[model samples]
Target: MTAGMPAEKSMNFGPSARRLLARLSPQRGQVLAVAALAVLSVACTVIGPKILGRATDVIFTGLLGKQFPAGMTHDQAVAAVRASGNANVADMLARMDVVPGRGIDFTALRNVLLVVLALYVVASLLMWLQGYLLNGVVQATILRLRADVEDKLNRLPLPYFDGQPRGELLSRVTNDIDNISQTLSQTLSQLLTSLLSVIGVLTMMFVISPLLAVVALVAIPLSVLVTRLIAKRSQRQFVAQWTHTGALNGQIEEAYTGHELVKVFGRQQEVQAAFAAKNEELFRASFGAQFVSGIIMPSMMFIGNLSYVAIAVVGGLRVASGAMSLGDVQAFIQYSRQFTQPLTQVASMANLLQSGVASAERVFAVLDAAEQSPEPARPARVTDRHGRVEFEHVSFRYQPDKPLIEDLSLVADPGHTVAIVGPTGAGKTTLVNLVMRFYELDAGRITLDGVDITTMRRDELRGEIGMVLQDTWLFGGTIRDNIAYGNPNATEEQILAAARATFVDRFVRSLPDGYDTVIDEEGSNVSAGERQLITIARAFLADPSLLILDEATSSVDTRTEVLLQRAMAALREDRTSFVIAHRLSTIRDADLILVMEQGRIVEQGTHQELLAAGGAYARLYHAQFSAAAVDLDEAAAAGAGQVPAGVGPRAGGPRPRIPAS
Candidate 1:
């Protein structure tokens, strides 16, 4: 979602500026020192022109008497002087202040140049030092921002991820952070330097000639107006660019990740169209932002050039009419250019600054996000499986005012495998999601070992509940890593042991790398059956007091299914487990099979007991295995009978033959 437009969204430059300043906290001393040196440099810059102007004026008024040669006639000297009266003339002149019969006093002018040059050197050195310090601050700030963003991502509730694309999250963390970095590392300090220089130049202009300075500065406000207009247009476009970039990245991720499905469906053209649309959106936004910001610099230069012409024409006429000295006009032109330089700097840098701000806004939007339903202050370190679970009159809704499970109650004793079978959207997942404390309950309580789950720390509650979701997702790491994900502290020996318990050893030990072989994200590189086994191994490694297997065998072939079934039976030994599945046949061995409808358990009992009762459970069981052929295939697969390949395990497909009944 785009950032909300609150009533307070108006540009408050003061706070943003303050935030920028605060990031330079530790280096403020260096900034101040550099600023002082820069001021000295500006002082020298203004004074040098005045000194040169004074020298020219003094020479024009004959303030410097001729150190003319004695042989020179008055007429010859007068002719030379008349020709040199033009300000553009550069004829050699002798100083009036020279000691007679000695030498010209060149020391004053030399010292003036030396002082100015020294100030420039000092200023340059200060600027370099500032560059280093500010960069260090910028890098440090970005690192902190990234770290904080990551921590937030980790802590946010599971539902948060369910609603957002992974690619968008990646963009926020990586691309957005890079934007802030580029702005800080390059444009930020330059803007500051230009702004400071502009201020100093303006002050100098006022001191030298206020009236002329005002005329030169007329362009400053005009350029700022143009910059603001351009910036407003570019700002909207930059926001759009980043948003579309994220969407495009998400589409690409989905495409590559789902390439097999896409090709199988022959939806290449469909995917191409979607991608093209997203890419075009991104391209247009980027181009528009760039084009608008690009126009700012040229506009600024136009205004600057116009200002320069105005100052030259006006000041030159004053000089020609004896209202100002030629030297004064020269100094005035320099000051006029100085006035526009800062405006140009602001225009050039505004684009970078806006991007950084937009990025920060996104980043802060995450940081400012509501915390993952707060955890317990001091959660118990729950290790022992007094796995007596109870959902005492619990109620919940994913959305407010739209309750899913209401006033529902259920219980499972320790070491019992509870199979909960329900139709789609009957609150099966919601019940478990609440039990895991992924989402808070609206009413009532769920307890494990007589302690309410909400009162315990989320990590502590989840730590003991090993989960195998219907759609298994593994990380980009080794087999060992995936197995040990549920409990990272698991020893290598323990991981192997867990793998063995889950039948993972059957496939894993045969692999070229065994436990060392890496798996892609969501186990994309591995066979579906193997991935299921890996997750089962994860549960085994966790050795949790409670286990949740949601459609654990639904995605696997019958061959793997048999192995998983055996492993499931083994895993149920001496632990509380919740089995959620639509394939009701597989959960026949559960200690308690619950037939749920509309978030309420209509029937629950042992297989034979439920069958004898001829209730909802019995009806479901019969509905599932009503066919004689289905019974024969299942029975044959379980070793009591045999079925030929053409007959299949279910309707249509052929099934592998086994022994006859």
Candidate 2:
């Protein structure tokens, strides 16, 4: 139904199918070659039984020549055969022993057997070639499909990823792609060969005896009906199974990613219970779909066997009635088996085909999703070094009706630090998102150096700005690599200098591998403060004209914070910077302090000026010290053995309290 969602109803095996086929257009020549080989393979196999039947007739005629019938002379038997008017039997009799029961025609039998053997060998070789070529074609098509999906992922907007589960999206790119590969590599060729066999066998059967052909074909409708009914019921279960599996994958990803938090909160049992519930749902749906689809093979086999028995019975009757030769009747039975065989095979594969198509539909849905609007045909480049930014009456909302930032306006002049402080939901991070153009505004514009950012190429616009987010992100790499991430081409000297500037060098030299040590994902092996330092170092290496530090010093200790402040002061001396921090003391000396509330700036001024005004910023600044004072009083009261009226024993001078048994 949507990107990152499991396929719902079975895809229309129509235009979407054609579109998938169109993807294979580049390999059309190879496809045609495989088809030609399949045709030859089917032809040889279909002709083999007919030739074998002739050999059987040859043996029968040899036996009959030795012993005609009870009292029948050779002449009478020949007359009877002539009246039957079968060319193959006549031809076989001509080569057999002339005298009655003289001897067997071993030489002729050997010749016929050789031809049959050669036919089979060639057919087998052709089949092998068909598979070999088809594999190449299928893989090439898959390669293109995978590339297209990867390109689509890069082109999609951030909101697309924000709404979809990473695990579900991964399933489409990996699991779904693999499904389509399996189907094309194996099922597609098999389906073609089976259909050809069915057509060729039917033609041969009719030529042998129209009545027997009719009897053999009775299973077609019956098998189709059974398979169709079961497939209809099973399709929904298949969809449900895939959907639950995706959900389960998402749950596993979240649980594992937040495993530390789960342990801290003692939620192991809760997480296990949730996983078990999702797993059970997946199992139920998978079992139902598999079990129901599994019924097709046996049901088709039963119907096929019924048809086989009828053809044998009726064909034997015709042979006895002199309406057909022994060879024709024998070939007819073989053809009857061949006809029902593909029917049974196709019936059994009904669910597999359905599933493959569903996977293709899911893959196609992602490819077809609306991509981010293209860059302007003639894009402007932001090359100004002034770092002047202005948000001009910009309005934005995650949802349309509930506006987060309505007609918001702000300006950051060159060579100044703008420290933004606000409550959690007061649109603080949104400002960074807007500046980077991660999302487009609903109305109005944002400008850099008085040039509208929307007109500039995204890469050119972002090149002038650098960010060190509150969440320090260091991918799996050596410390040197992480520090040089913002400037991949940075020299060893530059990297070391940035590290020293951020006070990161203090810890780097103490590590076992120094700058060469590899960190685990998310820098989990390092302390939070160390990771923050590395990110700060990375940003410093970039040395952009505009810097955004969103709570960059939040995780560091006071000593590290003081060092960072010194480094930042020097870095921000002649560069425009935006700093969002909760600790008022961190941004007390900023050139400008903007206090926000509910997406609106309630106060904007220097720290001293705001404190003098005694507005929102002043109250917030005083509140922090007041809360600290309250904590100190409680601690002092406990040390004095003076229990406050509502205080517990532990808060009353560390008194001995009864431990819970």
Candidate 3:
């Protein structure tokens, strides 16, 4: 399986190809119409050479039948069929045309030429019509394909994204889709035209002269053999090329998006080196595939020219024996060339189709990814007005083999603040993810207001909870638009009130454009604290019954934090809230405090009670206080220019001091 391939590996080339064709179901009528036009185009083109051959025969007969000044016709005028072991039947036959010019039939020859030209013009028009219709069908199919991909993205589980790079997925959506479009527009039409051309040319060759047709037919197997050999080798390279291109895309997205981190870590050279290596691999693979496929046209052309020469030699002998006409030999040579033309075209298209298939495989892989299991039949529906949440013996893991949360249980009472305090990697965010149904529980169940959450729709459960994470997300839009995202129908008054509550209005009013100031995609125009404030304002506007604050205030300054705390306190008046914080001071006044270590709750109680118990919470609280005191003392000592014993600027650092503050 390729990197980023979906778990459903059973969907092979046949199935993926079938799935792609299925997209054309709605446009079947249009497809048939285009095909009919293509066939007509081929028919007209095939008959043109035969009609031109008739004109050649007319002119040849005219020259031969005309009486010369010697009173002998052109045929009787040439006494010898061969001279000096040289085969120039045409030269020998035309030797008596000195005075036959007056008897030549220009009127009949003109009529045949006009018919040939008319057929060619009609063929060209039909081809253009076919292309115009096929283009519409191709675009319609692409539109549906895009819609399917977007729908698939919405249905896929969050863990699927967690394991795949955004750039790779983006490539599947943009690059892969574009590949399919190009293939449909260019390759498919060419394929149909080429196949029809080959068939039509073959029939014409045999009609003109079977002996020469045999020579022309020989080029088919040779062309096919060459195409097969090159396609086998180039197919693998094309697949690799697309895969590497996707990988390069991923690397570029990561490096450029996190350019600040790269600069800060001084890894500019490393990023460039990594990109260069990936790009080099892509280039080599792309060049190999293209070079191999490129040999087809020239190789087929050589075989085509050889066939033409063989036909001319054989047909000249037959014509001298009175078994063939000059026009027939001429048509046979033309047919031989036309026959190999489509063969070479099909060979080239074969290579192009291989690249398209590789892209299609990646696209199908995403569409085939395991989606979140279907919502249960007759799923229970419940409202979380009471805001009571419970986890009953819940166990979960991102990877099934490596358990993260095991047999954990907890309950948050209605209208109470439950502060979950844990060290990093203690599964703080996982708890929130479980409640949001972002990841389904491996064992046991969670409930909202005494109803099993699993029985309810995931959207329903998530709708009741508002979340503000440590990393704030804001799209490229005005401040008012960002806040209104959570509540699109929010009135101007409601929008202003939410912004005011989170102190977002303070900064917004200062800006020249105020609420209408547009931010970029990364929201780089604003400070981190300001972005966090905007997210908070968004949540406030949502007014979800249950609120989750996962280090929501970590980015703000002390003054902003104080204001945010006051704002949250007001919002939490009659709602159930879960606050996950590293700063114990932020959640010190919670109605319930759950001290966690690893993935289990080691201690739970009111803040003062836990402190009196001198457990993990008490130790954590004292450590923070001691760190604050040491910082203050160190600043004062620096001003006084004196070192405290075993504490300030010592070779060994002092242990965290437990001040009485």
Candidate 4:
């Protein structure tokens, strides 16, 4: 947990692969189609070689038929057979043979070449079809993989997001999955092609000569062993490669988000060094995986050539004698090459397998993470009615051994406002977070409208509570859209009315676009004060039965504070409002004010009543008085607006007016 970083605890491959397969379920038919094509291509490959071998055998016997002796040189045997035939048997024979065809027998030679041409054409077409279909499944599935990952991210728990880096997650969701998808597209077809070729070669070899067939397989086990070892090592390196890539992404994201701070601190060099280190780390790891896996293909090819040479040396003598025909030797050499082709292919694609699995693993991790538990087995609906809230013996903490809130309980009726005052880290936000169901309580319960808040659907409960934060969070959208987000179905007049309630209409009506202006990401286009007002108006538009205003004025200027005070008063009328404010002046008229310390309520009362009691509330009130006076004095020196501490024209006055028909 750096100053700002999210952990990669949810990274895994098992769940992701399963999810991928499920999504690719629709494309299984394509896979089967490709498989059928692979089988057909293999058939062509085997049959083509067999036909050439038969042609060789027929030509050899034609040249050596009924030789003068049982053993003779190829030329002597042709002389003897030609003596009997009354013509050059070599011419008749070579013409029938594909390899030599010394004197072309136009008909026989043409047939062999034509058959070879047909096999090549058929095999190429099948391979092309297989590649096209497989690639289609791979890329399409990956796009869906990214979409699903994004959806899961949207649903993940808030705590899951806290303290995590944005860049690392982006890497997993984008780069890693993309690498996997690419590997699948490039390797799957080649893998099947290589495999089918091997099978076809082996079967044809058996048909040609069983003894030579066994010799060709001598290197198969050795190749598989080497491949397995290299593949396992590659998997680890691929995982490391992806992890480093994510770390680099996290660093870059953080640097950009805090670009101003980095610039001010003159830490550009430092940032560069950090990024370069991670970048190099990824490079080294990926290089290791790729370099090792790359060795497998060439090594298998070398072994394949060696096996072919050995088969030729051994099978050649048999043909020289009366034991074999020239055709058997030719077929055996072809069969020997087949042994390593598939091995070579799988070895070639080992990198893709590793990277793909690594990325899918990371994706699966997020998909596998436990989501925020659903609201309940059966949820009670919340209607817009009385806003009665109670916290009964609620004890909660974000972490064990550090209680943020302990045995805390309280209640407020509808049409009432509750002000909760506490020092920083007194669990003010935690309390409201519980109410928001952002975190579950360790003990006790909270109720709304005479029913446990937990009994209501999470979305439905949130729909009935409006929150206005100190640092107002605004999405990039039009002014009207931001205000209308709370009630997307809201009419234009309803949005304007909501804006008016929070005095947001004043600024918005002045804009040239009125309601169509586009805001930057985080509403950076608007002033901080105006952003707060917009959020307040958004909450007002929601018209929830309960309102939660957390740190509503902590980070704003004095003039902005004044605006917030007005918005708070107007918005709190006729609603159940919980205002967590350190600025005592803002919540002075609360129907109930609870002064809290160390997660426990030390004092509870009306404003004047607590000031008269001269306890926690009195101390807080006086402390803020001096602070407000100091702030006002500072503002006076700087020519700025200020909020008067205790009493203004409306000090100790009745509640502000609520909108009525």
Q: What is the TM-score of each candidate against the true structure?
A: 0.84, 0.91, 0.90, 0.82
* lDDT tens per residue, model 1, 1-661: 4421111232343465467556666666766765665566556555656656654554443433344454555445544655767433222222112222233345654665676567567766766776776677678777777887889987888777777787777777888889878888887677767777788778777877787888977886798799988887787777777777777878888899899999999999999999998888888878987898999989999999988988888887666555667667777677677668777878988777776776666666567767787777777665567567899999887888666787888889887889898778888887788889888888999999888898898877888788889888988999988888878888888988888877788887788998899888878777988888888888878877888888878878888787777766766677788989888777878889887887777888888888899888777777777777776657566453444344555766444555565
- List model 3 lDDT by residue over 1-661, tens digit each: 1463222222244566677777888989989998899999999988888889878777766665553344554454444334434345535465323344345568978998999999999999999999999899999999988999999999999999988888888998999899989987888788899899888888887776777888778877887788777777777777777777788888899998999999999999999999999889889978987998788778888887887788888988877766777787788777777787788788778767877777888888899899998887877866438788899999998887888889999999877999999788888899989999899999989988888888888777777889999998999999999999878999999999999999999999899999999998899999999999999999999988889999999999989998888888888876889999999888988999998887899999999999999999888888888986777776566446555555544576544443443
Backbone clashes (count) for model 3? 0
Model 4 per-residue lDDT tens digits across residues 1-661: 4412222342344665565557777789998998899899878876776677666765655444433344455566455556777454344443332232133344775687689779979988987888888888887888787888888987788888784567878888888778878877777777778788887788878877787778888888877888877776666777777777788888888898788889999999999998897778778977887887788788888878878787898888666543556776786776676666677777777777767877777677778877887658889875647788899999998789887788999998887889998788777888889998988889999998877888888888898899888877888879989999989999999998888777787888888888798997667678877888888788888988899988766656787667666666666666789989888887878899988888899899999999999998888788877886765555454333343454233766643332222
lDDT of 2 by residue, 1-661 (tens): 1432345565475666677778888988999999999999999999998999888877877777775555565666666666788655544444443456444578888998999999999999999999999999999999999999999998898888888887777877888789888877768788899999999999888877888888887788888899989988887777666667667778888899889999999999999999999888888988988899999999988898899889878877666655777888888888877887888788877777766766687788789988887888888776657888888888889998787888888899988999999888999889878888889889989988888888888888888788988888888889999999989999999999999999899999999999999998778889999999999999999988789999989999998898888888888765789999999999988999998888888899999999999999988888887896775676667557775566665443544342322
**Which residue ranges in model 4 land beyond 4 Å of their true spot?**
2-23, 52-102, 322-328, 509-512, 617-661
Residue 548's C-alpha lDDT in candidate 4?
A: 92
Clashing pairs in 1: 64-96, 65-96, 636-641, 648-655
What C-alpha lDDT do the candidate models reach, one value each? Answer: 0.75, 0.83, 0.83, 0.76
Every candidate's CA RMSD: 6.5, 4.5, 4.4, 9.1
> Candidate 1: minimum summed lDDT over ten consecutive residues — where?
89-98
